[model samples]
Target: MTVHDVTAPDQERDREALMPEAVIDDEMIASMQARAGVNLRIDHSVNNEEATRIAVTKFAGGIGDINPLWTDADRGRASDYGAPVAPPSFVMACFSGIQFGWPGLGSFHCATQARFHQPVYWGDTIAATCTYEGFTGPKPSSFAGRTVTDHFLNTYTNQRGEVVAEINWQVMNFERASARGRSKRDDKKQDLTLPHPWTPEEIERVEMRVLSEKPRGDNPRYWEDVEVGDGLDLLTKGPIGLTDEVAFIAGGGTPIPRLKAHAASLVDYAAHPAWSFRDPVLGSSEPIYAVHYNQAAANAMGVAFQYDVGFQRQCWQVQLLTHWMGDSGWIIDCDAQYRGFVYLSDVVELGGEVLEKVVLDSGEHAVKVKTHARNQRGADVMPGHATIALPTREGASPVTLRARS
Candidate 1:
């Protein structure tokens, strides 16, 4: 399909209607700070209460991840975990974690740092809660001068009450009007109406690479066997389609509700009108989350076009390590940052290289790898690093990963 099929028709919205009139003032900042240390209700649907095979597989499929450790039950059954295990990042599906953004301002998920304590095994029931950790800045930003970085802490636990993962998520809240003024790419001047046109050769090259991805599986990536400059096999995802976004939503990647229709949706808007924006195309109120897939909503938010969700892209970055580390290894921690916007139909290539290797004082072997996700245009959209624990050639025990103290 052509780019036109996925992108919304080009239409302009009046400045007043495009963004909310809210400014980040002392009152707004104080109001947000007041909620610190309070447990906020998770607003999104939990896609998987039990990490069943189907749920695990669905999330794998959502990100185009074919790692057997997550997709093949038999492979997982035969591995060290004793049963099929969900991807470390699959904790995202279990909770509707909070991110504090001002009611009238635009918010962007800037970074995610997660420490994996344990695996979410196939039959485990997972639950979670989030607390507002408050804010850090009215700092210097390219988007808005008045930007504030809001913090949230999310804890995921299984039926056994063991902490599975704790994610420290950061979001930047900025005035939409100010952001629009500072946007680097002006939609009217840039040819963002359609996605990058691809030649068959380009499509084939990406397709071939995607089809070639395979997990290390039983072949343990022993720490002793790895080198600092070791390169990982590249994993490609997208020429992103709307279907890809929908699949992610089906797996519970987002907290924003879509198309609730009539009174139900109206009630939601009435209760949190700041969470709704007037769609220039439909001339109706659309949820703030619609910016991810709705062109009109995206434009209203100062983005050149609709783009992929930051968390979804962040997950793919971690997927790169999981596929490379093999089943025996565990992800100790991951820190991912969403740097650039990945628009519709963009193809993202995930790749990484081993940076350093060390044996923890506990005698657990681990390696640090620098990871990146670049779109077809070669923009580094998501960049991060991870610490992974692997078995040793001398038969040292795999490190028992745990949440930060």
Candidate 2:
């Protein structure tokens, strides 16, 4: 369990660097509570179009989003932002991490709720901070037995100090070994509950749609025009496999034995992966990053097989809405709650329908979409929804979120 620490010292001030130092317990709860409201300011620079394009594209690739507004220079420039803007969820990259230590227990993203007040453009500097919202703990769960929930709220601002985004995020911690047995039993039961293996043709058809998608680009989805029952095209990824998982980590920039230097650049802003344990199946050379690649580690953490990262699914939800809302629309809010596991080799189908439509007091037109990610078995594993402000044929998109006071 002696994985190498490749990051140099003096990488940002390790605010949460003290984590995995000990097991999370009553003492840890009190310690974190004492430090509530403490802010960790991390700044990221998007100095040029290429910088923004590369950053956003890497993230979009992780979720398999092929929208031209995020990938093509010509199409992006012609879009409403006048240039390629980061996806509404791109802010997730700037600042995430609870700052509370969870050493032994596997962490699960339970809920992610975010609000965007302004669009992020290239050449802007984003300054973000994370503050502890408090804690709820020692709860029982079939998923994470002996679970505890911690809340971390992140506020994102531009160089001008205008608040552009906020994320109210939560993660649950549990005893891994204890949860493993329950997970296996439930997984088998759930598999029995579902019928039908998706045919190769069915899988190929959806994969094509995901690749062929253009993001509703240039075509503005007028607000006053959307009907409640309008449905989105089915966006799918996989009969998942190693390539998909590895690609996600490549874009996500997680710690890999040989990829240490690449991960070191974000040392100041991102959490360090000090998982010292080696996967037994993969043997001594394996870094803890193998949780997604090593079946043994996956089981130790309560899944029979390697699984998709919850945050990855969160990105999928973001892509789902942007695909439907078009480039001219803005996603002002998004919330996702993970209900179950989506393992490697699972087909994930994503889509949504207009839940409601309304006009704000500011005269901004909007649509609320109920979106979700379902496994091949047709079980919904990630249920989410988003609110988008759309442009109108009568006038341009109005300023819905007023400038920060």
Candidate 3:
């Protein structure tokens, strides 16, 4: 598990440039503008209760929040929702969704601002869609030689037509030459030190803790009793690997649940080879967006290794508050920031503390938590904050984040 494991694929890719080499120029910017308002993901319906449970289970397991409320059907059914609830962040997994990179160009998911509208329950059908809001840049960005920001609006609605969540996500697409030059020129190198591989005993202990996780489902975490510095239950996850990454991606991006959409994409790519890149070694073709986890694509992006898909880290934070607040709680707002690389063989340990607890003018009770996820070396990779609403013994209503039937 040395840096070589992460960097090997990158070396092979250095021999040739990846496609979609659209440099930041007048023509490219104009094309982007004209494409604004176009739907990036077609509207579609998805329903697969069994897959929802399994998807969230894997999603939660990766982050360490194996709340039975999200993973166990029996426990979930006995509680309030009458079925398991998907993590508030599951929508992100959907939005990282079917990534379509700029033709021959690399794309990076840098940040997301998501507001939860309603909880997605198991058995509920969902219709989802996304539109390109437009481009905003040629502004300064250290990550790209000159970067332009692409903004997208994603919406999820249940079969009842209730909005599940609306997300405004931003990704930066840029010129690779400047990015590569800056990466090579920088004297301070990224710390890719391999950790002592986990022994049998250590691995067993971690697995035991994960199995022992208990969710605070029906019991209300009243705002009146919560303190300013209360701690949340720790859900330790990962020494995650390629299987975990592939399992997540295979879950699907199409409006239909599970692998249907992603499978359809594969079939479409095979029928229309123009949409995919053929890998001689893997002896197959893949979508242009495969760089999110493909080592070759990571290398092409000038990264030292294949890294954590951004949603894996982002959704973990959502699992944090949801586990602490119980099924009755609602996530009002979350702002997730991805700072550095989380390469393969990296374990992200996360924890959060209540920053404040107060009652809004509307008489709704709320608490804010600041959370951090650090790699094995203790370097912070993902830092985020979330506002959560908790029900009250005093009868104060939790703040309403989603208003739908």
Off by over 4 Å in 2: 1-25, 40-51, 187-202, 253-274, 285-289, 398-405
How does candidate 3 score on lDDT?
0.65
Give the higher-TM-score candidate: 1 or 2: 1
Q: Rate the local accuracy (lDDT) of all candidates.
A: 0.78, 0.66, 0.65
Which candidate do you rate higher for lDDT, 1 or 2? 1
Over 1-405, each residue of candidate 3 has an lDDT whose tens digit, in order, gives: 243345366765554335445577777777778989898744322323233666767655545555667787887666555566777766655544444435444566777778877778766666667888887877776766678768887787777777878877777777766666665545246534443367888778766866665667667788878898988766555676777677655543321112333578678766545355554356555555455467655655766556776666677777767767887788888877787777766667667789999776766788988888876678778787888888887663452233222
In model 1, state the lDDT of residue 81. 78
Candidate order by decreasing lDDT: 1, 2, 3
Model 1 regions more than 4 Å off: 1-11, 14-19, 43-45, 99-101, 184-194, 257-262, 396-405
What tens digits encode model 2's per-residue C-alpha lDDT throughout 1-405? 111346455542231112122345777667767866776433222112223667767766766778867777777567666665677666665554432455567677788898888877655667667777766877877665587787888787888777888989888877776676687567666533222256788878767866776667667778877889999767787877788777766564323222343345335224544443443333343344456766656655666667776667787888888888787888888899988777776788888888899887767888888887887777899888888888888887533233222
How accurate locally is residue 373 in candidate 3, as Cα lDDT from 0 to 100? Answer: 81
TM-score of 1: 0.90
Deviation in Å, model 3, residue 81 alpha carbon: 2.8
| Candidate 2 similarity to native, TM-score | 0.80
lDDT score, candidate 1, position 237: 89
Per-residue lDDT of candidate 1, residues 1-405 (tens digit): 123344333432242246575777889888888888888777444556788888888888887777777878898777777777788989887764443457778888889998988888888899887888888878777666688888888899998889989999888888887777666444445545356788889888878888888878788888888999999878888778888887887776775543466787889888777767776556777777877788777767877667888779878877888788887888889998988788887899889999999887867889999998888767888889999899887764363233211
Which runs in model 3 stand beyond 4 Å of their true positions? 1-17, 43-65, 82-84, 93-101, 184-188, 194-214, 253-267, 270-275, 396-405
